[model samples]
Target chain A: MKELIQLIASFVGAIGFSLIFGLHGKQILLAGIGGACTWGVCLLTDFLGCSLPLAIFFAAVFGSFYSECLAKILRVPKTVFLFSVLISLIPGSNLYLAMRYAIEVNRELAMANAIETLTVALAISLGIIVMLVTSQIQARIKSRGNRN
Target chain B: MSLTSVREKDRMADAAGVVRLALDVGEQILLSGGEVGRVEDTVLRICTSYGAVRTDVFAITSLVFVTAVWENGEIVTQSRRIKEVGKCMRRLEELNSLSRRICTERPTLAEAEKAFSEIMKRSESSWVKVLIGSLLAATAYTAFFGGDLKDCLVAPFVAAVIFGSQFLTKKIGGNKFFSQALCSFLATAAASFAVAMHLGSSVDHIMIGCIMILIPGISVTHAVENLIIGDTIAGLISLSEALVIALALAGGFALSQSLFGGLLI
Candidate 1:
């Protein structure tokens, strides 16, 4: 039940961003679903006792692959899906607390939070890079086969 | 062979036209927050399909370089220095679609230019749409972080004030860093006000949701992709841009953290 509500919340967040990003046509709903999927994978991994970074990595991989597939299907740029799909993955709260800890003079907690934030950022990037590399390699092999 | 053939000169002018059209497409893609690879590919594809013997397209965050060579050994080059960047997925979609057609169907220069202009002339997003969208975004962000109904209810109001100030700042056109901080100050202030009224439970949670609206999600995404795709130069530029924006966003909340809610951790 909790997971379901979180999924809906993630969906709503993406819909809101779809509006702000000026996404058009059927993309609005697709973007919302993309967010829900990211959140779901993230929550599931985190619940399975994986580290936070690992959870983010898995979620990001799913989200980026989803974006590529949706882009191909929708015939729009991948960014349309990229934005809404990854919104829920961003470590917004972690960054906020890091800033707060910095301001409050708790240098230790601030540094720890800051480093953790970096981990999340890196995990998300790693996920994107993984998907990007896989897709590029697939394209290369296909192109080579066409030549043969 | 030097300067006697008027027909040769006319062919050179046609090459220039193709280069210009290619640059226009690239400029729109870059301006609309496209990846470096996408921008480069679209420009090259359009130039090649339009009969350019050779083409080179290089784009970064703030500038675009497009060069095309004609069969007559005439070279045409154009550079567009982008002064601003904004997000409009619709424009990006249109550019992608148009580039596909240009590559496959080979539209004439005039036809392609006409189509590109029409894409640019699409109506600006109405303010009402933006405002409502922003409102929804902030409220939904609040819920994403596990905020209760009261927090969600208050966020849209806060988002309205933030958007209003953002609009005002546009008219004045002051320093970007200062404006970013100013926006953060306003958002934090509103969240603090709600906390003071006993309408919300945790200031950190609520403020986290509110400030989530300002984080540079798209910029960071592009920055990461650029860095990995061997576009070290463009990637680093946008990465720094994203870092600075993130710092400014944090600075915004830090500047007002004391004045609001007393560091409710």
Candidate 2:
């Protein structure tokens, strides 16, 4: 239950933040929910001591799908939804830390942090692409059915 | 008419025509060794007395005319200015040359490849860029005072808030100044809470993360880019925006610290 509440908070935070970019309240709210669920998955994987990379990959893929669904239902742009939802998973701090390390001439630590950040970014980008492809397929099928 | 007298009159008319053309073509009347005051005074007078449309001009290498939208869907364009004639000629020549170049380049795969490479080069490297920025900030903090894992880990929230503010400010439809202020205050207060609640690892850690978020990275980047590209006026505008936002973030932090003095993390 506590975890669930935190997930909700994360969702609210993501949605609230999304509003700054001219996103509609409803659309952002849905994005927040999607982001929250994705974050929950990542948190759970961490708690279970599983590979974080894998968790991030899965979370992104799922997040994309949820974003697409919300976009369809809400009649907003899917790119907006997906990008907003993906915000929850961005390793914003890790990048900051890596920079700090480099400035201080801590080469080893900086390199290590930098590598991890790169991997996380790659995973998220891959996941988003996958989700985009899937959504396109779904859209194609929906359009085809309507024609018949 | 006396020959010398007519010659002097013609020179004066040509000078007036040059000024008019410059004003009409939307060229910055303030050019190399040009003075803005004279152009401004002339424009004001022309607008007031002659019913000529006076425009807000931006100074760069030349005066830039920036009247994209107008009242009641009507756009008033005056073409009698010499500046307008010069600008149109240059534009036409450029367009013709570009078409010729495109045609020639289409057949050369190497040229197309070079064009693509140039486009990619213009965009920043997404992965390495973020990584380097984070690494530098982290190392500075960590080396000054040994590692704090929890705080460092949670610092991203502050980063998020800073980044999030850009989006929030745009979406909220509030005054840009007010939105920035509110965002900074909320971001600092949130960072304080995150640290105090033990949810975030450390105060310093969170501050480092959140502080950058408010740093007008985009505006600063734009200012630098414009300056490097030789658009002095654009660079100035971007720099101003960056300065305002940075001050707003600082003000927000100061206010938060003062309000909850003893309770601050």
Best by DockQ: 1
| Poorest 10 consecutive residues by lDDT, candidate 2 chain B | B81-90
Per-residue lDDT of model 2, residues A38-71, tens digit only: 8888887778886877788888888878877875
Question: Chain A of model 1, TM-score against the native?
Answer: 0.95
Model 1, residue B24: what's the lDDT? 86
**Model 1 global lDDT (CA atoms, 0 to 1):** 0.82
What is the per-residue lDDT of model 1 for residues A50-77, given as tens digits with 9 covering 90 to 100?
A: 9999999999999999999999887788
Q: Each model's TM-score, in the order given?
A: 0.93, 0.42
List, residue by residue over B194-255, the lDDT tens digit for candidate 2. 76787765554556445543455434433444454456675676578766865565566567
lDDT of 1 by residue, B1-265 (tens): 6643554455356887888888888998888767878889988988887667888888888888988887778788899998768777888888889999988877667788899999888835566767877887778888777888888888888888789878888889988777888888888887788778878666666777767678876677668778887999998988888788778877877767776657542
Q: Where is model 2 more than 4 Å wrong at Cα?
A: A1-9, A47-49, A141-148, B1-203, B208-265
Q: Which ten residues in a row have the lowest lDDT in candidate 1 chain B?
A: B3-12
lDDT of 1 at A11: 91
